[model samples]
Target: MPKRIMEGKVVSNACDKTVTVLVERRVTDPLYKKVVRRSAKYAAHDPQNICQLGDQVEIQECPRVSKRKSWVVISGGTGKPSEKRIRAGQDAAVEAVDTGKIQPKKAKKADEETVAEKTDDKK
Candidate 1:
């Protein structure tokens, strides 16, 4: 039989040579006959440390590499282009925020001013 393959997002890549992938699928409920989304996490071997958080990847069944890792990251699958663009955009945003290039807008305290006016009127 051919090895099983699954597509999922890399939720965690903190472990050395291993990443956690969250595979989500829709299944019809047996009793209700309604389609329900379900997800399972699998530990896949990532030898190159290439996968990052939120990276979508393809995992293939292989001989057990560890107690929990029986799958290997085969490819980026359908997530190659989007992943690179997202990561690049995120990195740029982070740098901009960190260097004070993009300052977040602060909300004016109009509510506070109104409360102060009410307190003054009562006094």
Candidate 2:
């Protein structure tokens, strides 16, 4: 079969040497008379690790690499556009002021003590 190519945005480049790209396509439903959007995630090989999250990318399907990485990044170009997911512990700061229901967890007292000791050691 001929090679298959799809255009999409780079969802993430956090993996050690791989980039996660998400390709979106629009298709019209014959029965419903509506257009639907669909997206598929692919892990692309990124040896340079230069592609940043949100960067648009083009991928070509090839023999399965490992398990989920069947696509290879052809080139790194400007993304015309899109949520992969945030890292496990790092999340964006909330935009609005806290309503008290939610507060940044106070650093535990033990952490504070450690900070104090570190400061003392530096002096």
Candidate 3:
């Protein structure tokens, strides 16, 4: 059988070589077909001790590292920057910055319009 890999943010890094990763799974009720989000926290082994709380890490199945740990951290476990994970983060930042089509930054203020300056200089 192949090992399973998961990517999520580290919610806890209080223990040595260990971190709690919160993995979210989406499921739908068979009867109602209602979409639901299921989340689980797994204790993963991070041997390098680089992961910090809130950091994003990729973990893979491995020989049991502890009573509760069934996975180990993978190298290049992308730290602070979650390159593409969407979770009330940078993507939201991009959206926050996008005020639809942007009004020119130098657009004259409403009270600053000048009629003589309105004619195109290029014309």
Candidate 4:
């Protein structure tokens, strides 16, 4: 049988040689027909300890590493920027918004403007 592989983001690397990966999947509700996102965290073995928090990684099923760990990290993932830098940028944006230093872009009311133009043409 083929082993399962999953792509997820590293949520924690606090444990030595082990990192927690968060895998998210979108599922549609049968009754409401709405899509909802659900996530699961799995502890994966990181031999080189290369994965950092928020870094996207690919994990594959492997022999059990410990009581709750049965996955191993695969190298050459998405290679996104470091999580710390990403969070710093995000925090700065949030701070700017909170301090009123910047304004969020408002969505354009294009449909409303088009209707108003049509009304003017008819009148």
Using TM-score, give the best candidate's number. 3
Ten residues in sequence with the least summed lDDT for candidate 3: 113-122
Clashes of 2: 1
TM per candidate: 0.64, 0.58, 0.67, 0.63
| Model 1, TM vs. native | 0.64
Model 3 TM-score on a 0 to 1 scale: 0.67
Tens digit per residue, CA lDDT, model 2, 51-113: 788886778888887777878887763342323323322343343324454566676899999
User: Per-residue lDDT for 2-116 in model 3, tens only?
Assistant: 9999877788889988889898889999999999989999999988888877887788999987799999988434456465665567667667679664344675565355544
lDDT of model 4 at position 47: 90
Record all residue pairs in model 4 with backbone atoms less than 3 Å apart, i.e. clashing: none
What local distance difference test score does each model get? 0.88, 0.74, 0.79, 0.87
Candidate 4: C-alpha lDDT: 0.87
Q: Give candidate 2's whole-model lDDT.
A: 0.74
Which candidate model has the greater TM-score, 1 or 3? Answer: 3
Point out where model 1 deviates above 4 Å: 77-123
Per residue, candidate 4 scores C-alpha lDDT tens digits across 7-53 of: 88898989998999999999999999999999999999999888877
Give the lDDT of residue 111 in candidate 3.
38
Worst 10 residues of 2 by lDDT: 80-89
